[model samples]
Target: METFLSNLSLGFSVALGLQNLGLAFLGCLVGTLIGVLPGVGPVATIAMLLPITFSLDPTGSLIMLAGIYYGAQYGGSTTAILVNIPGEATSVVTAIDGHEMAKKGRAGAALAVAALGSFFAGSVATLVIAALGAPLTRVALMFGATEYFSLMIMGLVLAVVLAGGSVLKAVAMILVGILLSTVGTDLETGDERMTFGLIFLSDGIDFAVLAMGIFGVAEIMRNLAQPESRDVVRKPIGRLLPNREELRQSWAPVLRGTLMGSILGILPGNGAVLAPFASYAMEKKLAKDPSRFGKGAIEGVAGPESANNAGAQTSFIPLLTLGIPGNAVMALMVGAMTIQGIIPGPQVMTGNPSLFWGMIASMWVGNLMLLVINLPMVGLWVRLLKVPYRLMFPAILAFCCIGIYSINSLPTDVMLIGLFGLVGYLLIKCGFEPAPLLLGFVLGKLMEENMRRALILSRGSLSTFITEPISAGLLIVSAVLLVAAIIPNVRKGRDEMFVE
Candidate 1:
């Protein structure tokens, strides 16, 4: 307890400095702007801004980058709720019920719930990191190749539950995504498997291109095809805050999601990305009226938004405590720390206690700043709904094109975005969901790499995964989920829950 209190004091002393606070605010502001812009994610934003951070002190540089990371979470939710375009993978779940709420003239309510939930989650996660960071890092380090592979298998099973329609079609989409992931060159061998002789294809498909094409461009196409009166912005804008019933429905989900996210975020290899998806699936399963999901359910919005933010904050645990980068964003942070001549890991906590704790303390302040920024901006975001579709869609197209082109300065990527847009439209027409495909695409390479490593470590013995306790447990759970998915009664229940 003394250590905790002492660390807290040190953290506040440094984080509360005027210069640090200003940097935190700037990061939050810039992060929100990046989030609001379709296809511009924090990874790109941080990479772009990294050189500027070299001029600042280590503590302030980290504080600002941390602020930008979580601030993007808040900003992404705004776009998802208002325009059905998710700026980040974490915001994809929000777009489901959130955009539905917007169509019902409840855009204000959705945005408010997202922002409030994120703030609550961020606050709790910061505390969790402060208290349990070391222990969590130890647990993450214990996960070997076998355990990691099993855990990802379980995650993919959960992704199966994320489907709102035909289970077979969802599974097929995942398989397609796995196939797409194999398009790049073999990591171990220099041979290309599916690039079809195109040099750009050798690096595999860009995630931003896929997301923008499917969600942004395809959505614009769909909206244009619809009658003008069918647009949701034409409806009266509803109240900004949730009512008594909404508050009651969302409270428990928020708490549950925060707990889930805190635990998952500490895992290596982008485990935090799975938090919101897991939260959404859990809320739907636990709901008495599961059928209300994907139709503007308050629980859907509250649970996932909270989980996303919590995961974003807690993902720093591995990096700070073990010097392990959990995702690309953390990888950039590792580079930032290295450039600042600060070595990461347990030694840094002892050697530079102020820098360590100050960054942690800044997370709370940043979350507070995000809340202050987002709530007032709710009115401004809702006003965007009033724009005409004709003008709005072209702007979206321009943004998507610019965002894609900015990634590599390649026109081929722009051409690929259009191609994927057409593909997305076809999939939508066929009643298939693109969300599962995305999950599969993201996890496929990780799963393949880990599984291969596990096999090699065990001398090609298949039983290695089963012999490891943690790996066995995860795979068992995955098997159970698979069996449950195939059972007649469970399938019927799932089908009913997803019925539109």
Candidate 2:
């Protein structure tokens, strides 16, 4: 405890320096802006801005980039809540209830809840990083390919819980997503499985393109088709802050999300992406009225948003302690550190205590900056709803196009957005939820990669997943969760049949 305190004090001292604070603030500001823009994710932003950080000290550069990472977590929900377009993958579930809340004239409350939840989660995760970084790093190291594959299985099973209706539809969407994830060239053999001879598809679909097209474009089309429904957003703006009751309801979910995210973020291979989904599933399962989900449940927004931010912060654990980058953004961080003559991993703590601890300390400062930056802007974001849909949607569509195009300078991606938009609209018409598909798409590639690796290591032995202790345990849990999710639907069907 004494040593931890001393290191923490040292971290704050370095992070509190004027230069570091300025850089951190700048990073957060830039990050939030990019995050609010659909399809402009932190990975692209960080990659582009990385060159500019060459001249700064290692600690300062990392502090700034780290700010962009978690700061984006705060801002990602803006579009999700107000416009139904999730600016980040982590914000996807946020859109489910958040946009619903917006339509009900609770935009202000939803945004406030998201910002506050994120800030609280970030603060707690930062402390976890400082106090438990070493032990957690060891825990992360224990996850091998077999274990990771089993964990992904569990995550996919949990995705079944995301649907508010029709378990079959949700399962179907997940299968479609997994199929789409297989479209790119096979990594080992260089064989294109489902590209259909299209060069653009050879690289596989861009997630931002998919997300923008499916949510933003489809939503715009839906609004245009039903002009009367557009007026729902123009409802009187209520309290700009969450009421006392709102706070009371949000606190438990925030705490639960923080704990779940902190634990998951320690896993390798971008386990953070699963945090919000897991939190959402947990929240829905625990809700007094589960039917209130997807329509506009405050706990849905609060829990998932908290989990998203907490996971974003804690993902740095593997990078800092094990020299492993958990995601693309962390990979860029590795490059940044390497360029600064700093080798990541266990040696960094002993070699450059100030830099390591300072980066850890800056996370807290960065979260505070984000809260200060986001909370005041909630009103401005809510005001955007007052604009006529006729004028606003065109701007949103144009922005989506520009953002998708900017991702790879590919006009085809812009075209793909249109294609996915139609697909999204069709899905909506058919009563399918897109959330399960999105999660499945995101996890599918990682799952395949890990599964293949595990198989190769075990000489194609199918029993390796069962023989590995951690892998076996995860599979067991997945089985239990799957059964639990399915039994409810079956029971409901039986009751309805009897009623009929």
Candidate 3:
């Protein structure tokens, strides 16, 4: 306890320095801006800005990047509340009640609750990281290839559960993501799998290109296709903060979300994505007025928003401590760290306590900066809704094209984005989620590496996967989940999720 406290104090000292604070503030400001804009999310924005981090001090660079990540989580709710569209997938539940609240002229209140809940959740999650990082690292390093693969398999199954659409469609989308990841040269054989003899295809799809194509461009296309009606700005703005009764109602949900996020974020795979759904489900089950959920319940916004941010923050611990990224953004973070000659493993703390703990403490600073930046700017964001779609669409298109092309200076990437944009739109039309597809794509590279290493070590013995207890148990769990997902009862629920 004493050592942890000392480290935490050291972390805060570093984070509070003027330069770090300024960078944190800058990151949150940019994060919230892009986050508030329709069709923009953190991953795309982060990838676009990644090159800038290369020139920064590692601590400041990471602090800024981490801020942008969680800061976007907070910013996403603003758009979700003011508009029916959710900026983040985790904010879907928030959109349920939050947009309704906007329609009911309580947009201000909903936005306030989201920001406050996220800030509170982030603060608590940081403490959880301080207390749990070392222990979780120990736990994560125990797994081998079979275990990792099974864990990923289980995550894929759960992804369908969280995918909010047809399980079959979700599975299909995941298969597509895996297929996309396989486009690069085959690792085992020195040959290309699906590169079509094009030099550009040899490196596979970049996450930046894939994400911008699917989420950013595809989202813009969807918005343009649907004619706008019922201008949401029609609602009158309410008070900026929740009332006492509202506070009482939200506290329980906040606590529940924080705990749920802490647990889910520790798991590998797309567990972070599932965190918000779990919190929303729990809140709905625990609510006194369940029917109020779809009709604009405060708990709907409070719980899931808090959960997403907390999950986003806690997801970092695994990436930093074990070199295993729990989500796409973490994977990107790992990439950034690697470019700077930092290897993520048990040695990270021992080798670079300043970077590790500094990041921990910086998360708190980032969260604080988000609230400071967002609260006063709530009215401005609300006003941004007044911007005409005709103007916004062109701007969004410009951003997407510029962002995608900046990656490799390849018009081929732009073409790829167009192709994936069509693919993503088709998946949506068919009731599939693009999020799980991303999870599959992000993990595929690492999964292939681990699988090959384990195979080589075992002299090509396939039995190696099931021979170890941890590996065996994970495979067993995945098998059970796969079987369970096909059960009549489960299938019925899955089919109903088509609206997602």
Clashing pairs in 2: none
The runs of at least 3 residues in candidate 1 whose Cα sits more than 4 Å from the true structure, single-residue gaps closed, are: 1-118, 129-132, 226-363, 377-379, 488-500
Per-residue lDDT, model 3, residue 496, is: 87
TM-scores, each model vs. reference: 0.63, 0.62, 0.83
Arranged by TM-score with the best first, the candidates are 3, 1, 2
Top candidate by TM-score:
3
Cα lDDT tens digits for candidate 3, 1-500: 88888899889988999999999888888888767776667775665565566568888888888888888888788878887777776677788889988888888888888998899999999988888876766676676666666555665666655445466776887788778778878766878888888899898777667876776667766767777642455768788988998899888898899889878876655666688889999999987778988898999888988888889888887677766566667756765675466766656777788888888998988888888888887878767756666677777677677766765689988888788788777766767777767767766766677778888888998798889788788778777776776686576778889756
lDDT against the true structure, each candidate: 0.80, 0.80, 0.77
Candidate 2 residue-wise lDDT, 1-500, digit = tens: 88889999999999999999999999998788767755556765664455456668999999999998898888789878877878798999999999899889898899899999999999999998898765655565677888878866775675565345677887898799778878878879999988889998987876666666666677667667764322325565466699999899899999999999998887654468889999999999999999999999999999999998999988898678756555656756766786577866666777788998999999999999998999887666545434555765677677677666765788998798789889988898899976566656666776788899999999999999999998999899878977887898899999999999
RMSD of 2: 7.9
lDDT of 3: 0.77
Model 2 scores what on Cα lDDT? 0.80
- The residue ranges of model 3 lying beyond 4 angstroms of the native Cα positions read 17-19, 47-62, 83-85, 95-109, 144-157, 186-189, 233-245, 264-301, 322-352, 489-500
Better of 1 and 2 by TM-score: 1
Evaluation by lDDT, superior candidate among 1 and 2: 2
